[model samples]
Target: MTTGPRGFRRALNRGIPRRNRTLVALVAFTVVLTAAILVWPTVAPLTGLVVPLLLGSILLSPRQLPWFVVFLMVMLMLAIGRQQTIEVRTVIAIAILYLLCFIVLVTSFRRTRLGVAGVLGESMLVDLRDRIQQQGGIPPLPPVWLVETALRSAGGTPFAGDFVVATRPRHSNRLEIALVDVSGKGEQAGTRALLLSGAFGGLLGALPPEDFLPAANDYLLRQAWAEGFATAVHLSLDIGTGEFEVRTAGHPPAAQLTAGAGRWTVHEA
Candidate 1:
């Protein structure tokens, strides 16, 4: 009913995606072994070495896979070229060579280090999401999280006007966050989003709701050039204060949810 780390690792190994190159090499080795066994009965046992080499490659990197293939080819050539007479010295020499080449090839593939950068990037992304949750923000659910989750993107990447921040501390207060989608979608528009996010992040942290809009706009004007303009919404909610405020400019209005009613309205500042 319970599993330890080893069991969990085994499960993970079983669950590993079979579509990766490792699985590809394994399948290729199996097919090649079966063919060799059927075609050359006398050398059928030697075909077993192919599987181990392929397995090593799976535990290695794409860059080292070619060397593994080369090692196997060399061994196969040596075995095939020799006469039927079995000599102890020849067998020992071939084994030593194979072992040396395998060691060198494993060292070269470096599965342990090859994908490290990608692994680190993924870990950092998770850490960012956890930090956002700690800062009273909610992350977007899956599928969206995989591609273009505003919440995830906002947390992981630098401040961008991609998502809103909201939090409700049960013992204290409640907050409603609204995100503004800019008029365009590109690097230029994205730069403006960054500017807006910086301005909003600063103003929302300290300024009152009334001062937030003007302060954000002033900051944006100072940062963005003549060709750069942004439309945004600033939303604040105070359940204890029994008040809500939204200031916006040509953007989607926030939806207010109540026990029995739903309403849509826009607030322009």
Candidate 2:
């Protein structure tokens, strides 16, 4: 009952519409076959070879292959009835060759699709990383270098529910940071995270340090999703004095490390 790669693949296949070039080619091939039947009655048997040839040129799903095979059989029978001395071996050889060609076509199409998807996926990741950087992910504070920092998604996916946005206001001596967790996970939560990141990034340095969290709360309240809720911690720190204030909403307490003691202490702000 679990959805693994195969299940996800099936879901994706169902969701995406594949181009039906084979159907169109089949129509054209049918027209040619009909014309041969009407105009050159003696050549009608040879014209049936074009059906399998046309089918082999395109990729086909398992469900469509049976119907195409039936069509080819019917065409072959009609061709046999119109002509004498039609070699059964020749027909079989042609069918085998067409099957091989169909397999090759399907393999090539799969490889091409996978290659294109990989390229596009990597490009999108690069763009998303650049956007996160532009929004000021893990701000650089002078004389207060971060000891360690890490961000991870729920299940090692590209999209995540948690996000951090940090900034130093213009002409101000304080650093503002917000760690937010959206209601869901994976792509859906990542979408909301991106939206909130944009909104919070804009609100962070623009508003007073004390007003930032309140503004964010108001923004979340105005959103249309009734069931959606988020947890966040907003921190404001003085670069010169090292004085800091932390605010939280439905989030865990902030922790501080005492370098000399080599221990961590939790702060409920």
Candidate 3:
């Protein structure tokens, strides 16, 4: 088994996720700086640096913030006790610290619009993913054929770069479906996927078959994202005649399952 400092460090590393490392580092820095000022009161003006550090509270959860705030209060009180003659600069620094802390705390409290979580918290993202699922729901297919679809991102997350939007427009026998793969690999892209899914679902049936892809391309272009490129396949099918047209933009060919041969074949766009 593992022993001592190296092993302890390894265990600690495993305890926190990569995203939270910055918070842990800042907390350590605050403690070390506080100790330094306690030993050398001449450096008390440096406490203002802590105010800027707390600005990181924007990314911190409510409960996680108290650690920094409480410790900061203790550090300030200690500095006040140690410094006999507080300089003008030191007084200004303390005032700025108090103002900044108050602002950040207020901002954190106001973020309670989600009741418990932030407005763009994980819960909100999950809700968006559910909406995307609902938007991608295939309309009631005719009895003769079975249709199945699968969408999962890398590592099997609820968030994915790939999404589908489908609809059978009112008074129309045609079913229009679009499978879009957006660029990027994380939550930001997943959120974008949900938003695009909504936009594409509306455009799919509302625009003529020939106009849909161009309209979608135009819509995406207007957004002007840096990594904005997306691949999409648009499929339009006639319920009665079984005739269909498949179009693609930077996406793979549509696949057809040959039931008799039990194999998948690619349909050229």
Candidate 4:
């Protein structure tokens, strides 16, 4: 029988799909912003609104972005048309805005695939990287044992072809470690690294020490990616006995430093 302003707002919000709401709001704000810029075209800095709108568009659906761009293009054209004589700075500003729009639009398309928003896509990549790092971490070991791991990408970037996954399985005194180098370097191999990191991490302590590589090989074969291959080293070490088995797959041999002899011994792969 009665509805408050808040209730009306809630009802209105419920009508629009959750994904498109940001796009719609940004487009509406653009219209108002365009109006203000037009009203005081000479007084106001026209390019002031460009960055915010473009940044906001990253969170919007790619399909929704083209439409938003269309609205933006129309607003920009109308603003220029309304002016009796456009300044050189105005034309330069407009050109810069167009270039930014093109860059942002291209980025949105490349980053957001299969209907995923750019923000979500980026967050997912971050989450995957975090998981890889977490999996790479060596859990707290007893004081007697020391296990070390280090990873460096081909370049100075978060994404890389190299990663490691180590785990101490329940009901076992053995530590399982898998060192993987996916094909390519940096972003080119980052996707494959993310994928194999999880899979190799899962397979690390799951199977018997000797079965790990064959299983990993099987998993890689299933994907059937052309020129897609990875090099990995699996090491399962028994803390009690100080005995270990290092399995290699298209990877370099393991090296060990003999403390007493003060020499490095290379274990054949």
Candidate 5:
């Protein structure tokens, strides 16, 4: 509901998908190994090879850490067996260096990843906010102020299953607004909400008020998704006069607030 530091952290920690991370790790590990092999001849006894290998492993996802560890162990054994003249104390010291390097490199990689992800997520949110503002179809000004909000259960994304679209036709005194709830929830439903918002917003003031519901019904029937039903409330209001017409499709009745009596009344459309 609130966008702050905690929310930014949550978005960053959302992390790249496991499959993509694995692919990136594999590519990075391959490149590091290839480069090490190319330079293996110049580095005698492979005294510091394990450190670079451990650092390379930091590119890998947590699930892939074991594979990298096994590879490192195999390489270490081969290097030790080939260089029998190398001292045991030197081998032990190299192992210690490798361990320290692994710890530091992994910690640094994670922080860097979070930093990059935070920037990426903030950019994505900015883009989404701009698109929603442009395509939301909300009128600049209206006789009545309508407050709309949506809460998503899917990782606090701004998109949701419910949406509102409003428009005031040119050379007309009527204000048309539609509140729609799609069949599903979270990101999946948010997609449908986006599609329907565009379609309904375009059709809202294009036809006479009476034909709006029938056209929307035809559009939905054409979609023909299994168990894909939506509930919508369409309101057409006169700007000068306090008269309005409401149409509902499988939606709950709307409530009216009376300022004179300071009471609320529910009306079924």
Candidate 6:
């Protein structure tokens, strides 16, 4: 059966922390070497040997394999040198090959980082959101059910039609929902939208419209470089009172529909 790296990761599952320490060390070493190469290219030839050394160390564990591969690219580039070597055609061919390889490597690393960040970020956000809702001093009588979607939509293109839903407590009850169209799309948009949905869901229970708006504003400002902010609305209706409270935070106005009357209204918050 397969052993080695699999065995090591399994052993790590048995409560040993040293395996994690080793992985961190290897990653840090790779980052340091990459930085050194970029900042001090004069010494690049010497640091270039780190690629093979790192690869040899990979047999010690599986976690650092990607870092070693990256180091290999550094080594190859340094070997090519900046002083120029072959003909223009040969140089062009080599550059194209290197570009293709770099694209593949970077894309793979980015996807991996996204998956890891999703797990850890989701966990931390869940806890922090719960705490904020609890502190907001006026949670909804019943918890709201929320739905989050990746910004990819059904097709493989970026779209801003992301949405969230909050179901009332009873099966026969009406639902309070929020459909937010973020300012951007793709990974960055999806991540920020998810965060905004969670933050709004939690705060809708506890804070007033003004405070909630500013809170979400500050959150998004920290996330993106532009002046963009979410345009969202909070909608809720009382079963007995038949009244609603609608809040907007730079988001689009919400649409309300009545079943038998066939009348629709776009709310302004």
- TM-score of each prediction: 0.39, 0.55, 0.59, 0.86, 0.54, 0.43
Error of 1 at 269 (Å): 5.2
By TM-score, the best candidate is 4
Better of 3 and 4 by TM-score: 4
lDDT tens digits by residue: candidate 3, 119-226:
347667778878899888888988985567777778577687889998999899998989999998866577678768888988999989989999999999998888
Estimate the Cα RMSD of every predicted model relative to the unseen true structure: 12.9, 14.6, 13.0, 2.6, 13.4, 11.3
Give the per-residue lDDT of model 2 (tens digit) for 56-136. 434444445445545655665565566555478757755664565466446545645444333344576678766865665
Which residue pairs in candidate 5 collide? Answer: none
True lDDT of residue 156, candidate 4: 81
Per-residue lDDT over 1-269 for candidate 1, one digit per residue giving the tens place of the 0 to 100 score: 54999898777668775435564565466557645744663666553655556465545455545555575655566444543544687577557656755674655556445443233445655665454334435433223222121443433444333545443433445454546554444443555664455456555646666776677668767865767666666666665565777777656555554535665444445
Candidate 5: lDDT over CA atoms?
Answer: 0.66
Candidate 5 local lDDT, residue 53: 53
lDDT of 3 at 76: 69
Worst 10 residues of 1 by lDDT: 140-149
Task: Tell me the deviation in Å of residue 7 in model 3.
Answer: 61
lDDT of each: 0.54, 0.70, 0.78, 0.82, 0.66, 0.54
Sort all candidates by lDDT, best to worst: 4, 3, 2, 5, 1, 6
Q: What is the lDDT of candidate 1?
A: 0.54
lDDT of 2 at 56: 41
Write down the TM-score for model 4. 0.86
Name the 10 consecutive residues with the lowest summed lDDT in model 2: 111-120
| Candidate 3 weakest lDDT stretch, 10 residues | 111-120
Give candidate 5 regions above 4 Å deviation: 1-37, 40-137, 142-155
Off by over 4 Å in 1: 1-161, 167-176, 186-199, 225-227, 255-258, 261-269
lDDT leader: 4
